[model samples]
Target: MKQKLIFFIAIAICFSSCENKEKNQSVILKGSIQNSNDSVLIFYYSDKSDTVFLSGKNDFRFVLDLKMPVYGYFRINKKTINVFLSPGDSLELKADANRLEEITFSGIGADENKCLSQLSEERTKQEINYEEWFSLDEKQFVFKSDSAYKAQLIFLENLQHKFNNLNPFFTKTEKARIFYTYAESRIAYERSQVFSANSKQKLSPAFYSFQKEINLNDSTMVFIPEYQIFLKTYLDKKVYEQEKNYETMNDLIGAEFDIILSEIKQQQIKNYLLHSVFRDHLQFNGLEGAKDLLALYEKHTTNKKNKDEISSLVKKWQQLLPGNSAPEIALQDELGKIHSLKDFKGKYVFIDFWATWCYPCRREIPHLAKLHKEYSGKNIVFISISIDKQKEAWEQMLKIEKMPWLQLHTTPDAKLLQDYQIYSIPRFVLIDKEGKIVNAQAPAPSEKKLRDMLDMAL
Candidate 1:
């Protein structure tokens, strides 16, 4: 009797274990790539990244624990596959490695993914060229933008209804995704119309109705790319609308803070915008009148982590203040000539860290040329280092532009990056003739103060 009872207990325990295992099974994302064998593949979303090696037949697979629906990036070398993912999805794909964009999906969420694919195809075919868009009248522009947004909204509504039974949460997130995109279209339409209108043809009241619908404090949408962009657009518009209220730049910054604190109710969103504004102000203008802003952030924000992170950045910026020895950089010139920061020791170096793809960086090139010409015989050197991954493209651009300053290229990830904490590009660093950093975070070539600083350095 004792042995039989022990056997029954063992079976019950085994059954319980099996049930738990079945319940814990994750969302599976597996696929195979045809043509060209690449050893490594990468999958990324938001702040998370995962890397895996390919099989002999270019087959790849990923098992993920997903709590909510989101977009993810699947990459094979330089090629990328954008995908929509959700729980209980056993997603499968067979794609051509050379044409990563063209893919077919199968399994649980196959139908929804197909809809996304259709939209992607539509976007590629329907996107208006920049010059073509600018040529359109305000009415035409508004119609085009509105139509695009409306069509996407209709599609999203139908999709949500179809998938509502599967997961209401998933459908809601999908709606948010589409809504994020709609925000971009809305902003673009209004901006184009506003730019063309004369003083008497004031429009904002007509085209900006959608702005009132958005919840400024919704941090839940932070993970969406379009949502992040929308926040930037919204905040920028707020600054422009209230520009007349503030007289000086410092006053403007203070007003921006007040607006954010008053309008944004979520701690996370406030913390993000506060940290962003503070960091950017520090980056461009240095620490002048910024201590007050930092104190304001500390007083208003309740997020400990965000406060700590900004505090750390504040300390780092302090270290990068004027008169500090510039971080050492080693790079090669266009003709396979190796050089170091020390090579330009005798002359004042107007060090510009830029990339070919950056529009602001390209815009500053003309200013740099003008400055170089003006100070041609002076004791200064204008050196631009490109952080471009493609050497051929960089060379082509330089040849096409005929830049009059020293041009050099470095790999995308370099030691120079770590030493300088250079987060954004088109950054200018003014190093003294004695090889010491005069302004570690110097003004841009286009800034009027840049010339004054350079004159003082010389």
Candidate 2:
């Protein structure tokens, strides 16, 4: 009896200790930020649902209570510090009074010191290269020997390789180095390739190859200055003429005239291409689209006959904004019930353009479901139209998510996408009772802007 009692007590004690350990293993993130103004420190978990926000202050400290290891950002103004935190580990982030190099966690760690030393060395080398390239006199280069240009090419190549290798190990200083190196190298390469090209085809391929090599998407976050420099250099070289005086020019001019004209046409094409690429980047960053291209079109194109063509593109974009009348859509619901814009005309309607393959759109379904439940009795209709090419995937998502709103799919012809001008998904349009555009390019109802607009409209 005594042995059995002792055994039972031991078991109970072990159970209690296990429970305590489980409770104590929560992830804790603690940090201090200094000299921050209106900066929000946001931490987003990998699971994507959990997020915590901390407001910045003159001397700010915060402790985030989390359940597991996560990756998060500490944003101060426009600058951000990204870190990975594990459970039960205490992290101390100390930002400087000036908000630069304050130090993270403890004293004189070997890895930290090594990183700082390497970053310093890289920055110094990059500064030397920048001075050498930028200080070169363009007039001297006009009559210079090919040897000088060749040497510049060698220097740029070596610097570019060094920057690429150091990029993975980059601190903020190293990031600056990489940006400058890329700018100098790209400018040098563009000058050489453009001046040396024998034909229009060759020039196009060279430019395309250079763009592909730089991999613009990789540089999206930290290469803004470099990108601007590249664009300037490219445009300058694009306008360079083979002959100083076209009146006296003969063989070279005649041979290159067609090529030059073709190049001009190609430039127009490239302008649109680059604008589209930049627009995509802005969208990814959740920024308002740049109107620079529209301004350029208005400035240069003088053909009043093409007004309809231009207006169509602009109108499509306008319809994408908030409170815009949902485009006239025709699709079949889950039960093969035919629905149209007119069917839900009496009430406010949310036409959500989405697809099963879109991760963001998939993540938003639960939020939509909640909204559907909340506004079920109200004179509001939520309709999700999937543009998935495959009906199987659409049906699968509908079943898995158990979405409460009307689910519909268009035929694989993609007519609906074309009609709606939907180049991207997770887009929503809110139509008011009268069907006139209230907010075009409106975000989905899950966002605060949409909610506010809906409240007003209702």
Compared with the true structure, model 1 gives a TM-score of: 0.75
After aligning candidate 1 to the native by TM-score, how far in Å is the CA of 246 from where it should be? 5.4
Give the per-residue lDDT digits (tens) of candidate 2, residues 251-361: 222333333334434333334334433344333322233354345444544444333445566655565555555567777987888988788778887778888889898
Task: List RMSD in Å for every model shown.
Answer: 5.1, 22.2
lDDT per residue, candidate 1, 177-229, as tens digits? 56666666666645655565542344546666666668777766766666777
Error of 1 at 67 (Å): 3.2
Clashing pairs in 1: none
The parts of candidate 2 lying over 4 Å away from their true place are 1-293, 300-311, 318-326, 411-413
TM-score of 2: 0.40
Flag regions of model 1 displaced more than 4 Å.
1-25, 34-40, 126-142, 156-166, 192-199, 204-213, 217-220, 245-254, 271-289, 294-319, 353-382, 386-407, 411-418, 421-426, 443-451
Q: Tell me the number of clashing residue pairs for each predicted model.
A: 0, 12
